[model samples]
Target: MSSSDIFIGETIGTAILILLGGGVCAAVTLKASKARGAGWLAIALGWGFAVMTAVYISAPLSGAHLNPAVTVGLAIKDGDWSNVPVYFAGEFLGAMIGAALVWVAYYGQFRAHLTDEDVVGDLSARAADTKAVEAREKGAGPVLGVFSTGPEIRNPAQNLATEIVGTFVLIIAVLTQGLNDAGNGLGVLGGLITALVVVSIGLSLGGPTGYAINPARDLGPRIVHALLPLPNKGGSDWTYAWVPVVGPLIGGALAAGVYNLAFA
Candidate 1:
């Protein structure tokens, strides 16, 4: 495919990916949504389905490398860096657009969720099982998890390691199983296989840092989180932001190295 096709395809595919993926997070996190309190299995499966859908839509145009980690892994494997910037541009832009669309889709829920002073500020008033409410600046922010990942435990080294390992598995799967005959994009069944792989990683490794195996997936939505004007929305947690991006890139590079040595 041409560069224009690659850019447009990635932008649209990634937008669709984040729209549904983040939409699930919003559905589970927002107060007025019916899916609120749906557990992690819902999230993992939702994201896997999102990947499947997006890849099927964009695989012909840009190989549907919606995640930067996947794109980087492919680039490294092929020893080609010329189109990396274009891929990054489309992926990040699509992620932000998708996050914004999620906000639009759940605007009422967000207003209700964020404006609840008792929910935002009063831990005593919250339900015993309320996992979505988090206090910051003495009030709650829109749940960051809907837009980006955060660690269950705030250990930086461990958090980084978790992202690295999760992304390594993801990149390895893309390299080994999710390639077309031309080896540029996913095969006809690659999307489904990759989606299942994503589900597996999320089920097994998502606990630590929410399995942010993609840099653009985390950073773009983080940028959206910082920019959006939601009342009582807490800080964007920028201190931990680099872990998702850096760890996945490192993991992608590592996966590519392993593929070259063992599989290529």
Candidate 2:
């Protein structure tokens, strides 16, 4: 694929991926939404479907490597780094755009959920009763799971390790799977299979850091969460931001190393 194709395809694919993926979070988390409280299974399936949709749409043009970890793993496997930057540019840009669209689509729900009397009251009383607001913000606005992932327990060591292991599994699967024949994209059925892998990861490994596995998937939307004008939106938690970014890169590189040593 040419640089332009890679950019365009990744941009569009990642946008769709985040749109559907984030939309699921919004749907399940927002109070006013019909699907609110749908639980984690919905999220896992939603993200799986998101990957499938994005991959199918962008595979022809850019191999649909919506996750930066996937791109880096492939580059390491192939020993070509020229297109990595292009893929990164597209994935991040697309993630931001997709997050913005999710906001637009769920504007009413966001406003209702964030501005609810119980929630606003907690925000006002946070200095005195932090736990009171924690209930409201568990999955609601300000610190939404839709846009990005967070750890159940705030252990940096464990969080980083969780992301690395999760991403290694992902990249390793991509490298070994038959869908990766082209070296640039997955085969016709690869999208569906990869989506299943994502769901499995979420079900099995997602509890601890929400299974970011993809740097662009986490960081880009986190950036939007920080910049977007959402009422009562809490801190973007910038301190933990580097964990997802760095962990995924390390996992991708490690996966590539393993692939080179064992399979290549």
Candidate 3:
């Protein structure tokens, strides 16, 4: 594939991936949405479907490496780093676009959810407590979860470890079983299988740190959340942002090492 094809395909595919993935979070979390309170199972299934759809849509052009971790792992596995920067650029740009679209699509819900009297009151109450204040400094705000992941408990070491392990599993699966015969994109069946693996990771390993196995997935939306003018939306929790980005890259590299040593 040409560089233009790689960039365009990845941009479109990653946008769609984040649009649907973040859409589910908005639907389940926002107060006025019909799917409010649908719970975690719904999110896992939604993301799985999102991955399947994005992979099939973009695989032909750019190999459907929507996640940065996937791109990094493939680069390491093939010992080719030529197209890595292009993929990263497309993934992050597409992710930001997708997140902005989600906000537009759910504008009314976001307004209602953020400006609700009860929610505002709760935030104010929490602000007064010293510990809660500290947590807010290092953790996400009320609506951040709709755009990005956060931890149930605020232990950096454990959170980092969880993200690393989750991403390791995802990249290893892609290296072993998710690639097409062309060795660039996912095959017809590989897309479905990869989607199932995503669901499995979400269900089994998503409890802590919300399983941010993709660096672009977390950071791009988080940046959007920080920039968008949502009323009463608190801090972006910049302090915790590094964990997701660094952990996934580490996990992808480690998975590539294992693949080279054992599978290659």
**Candidate with best lDDT:** 3
Q: What lDDT does the true structure give each of the candidates?
A: 0.89, 0.88, 0.92
Tell me the tens digit of each residue's lDDT in model 1 across 1-264.
Answer: 788998999999999999999999999888989999999999999999999999999988998999888888999899888888889999999999999999999999988998787557664555343453443632224578899998889899999999999999999999999599878779888999999999999999998889989898899998898899887677688888899999999999999999999998
Backbone clashes in model 3, listed as residue pairs: none
By lDDT rank, best first, the candidates go 3, 1, 2
Q: On a 0 to 100 scale, what is the lDDT of residue 47 in model 2?
A: 96
Give candidates' CA RMSD values in order: 4.2, 2.9, 2.1
Screening candidate 1 with a backbone cut-off below 3 angstroms (N, C-alpha, C), the clashing residue pairs are 141-233, 141-234
Distance from true location, Cα of 114 in model 1, Å: 0.4
Clash counts for the predictions, in order: 2, 1, 0
Candidate 3 steric clashes: 0
What TM-score would every model get versus the actual structure? 0.93, 0.92, 0.94
Model 1 TM-score on a 0 to 1 scale: 0.93
lDDT of 2 at 263: 93
Mark the regions of model 2 whose C-alpha exceeds 4 Å error after superposition: 122-141
The segments of candidate 1 whose C-alpha lies over 4 angstroms from its true place after superposition are 122-142
Range of the 10 consecutive residues with the lowest summed lDDT in candidate 3: 132-141
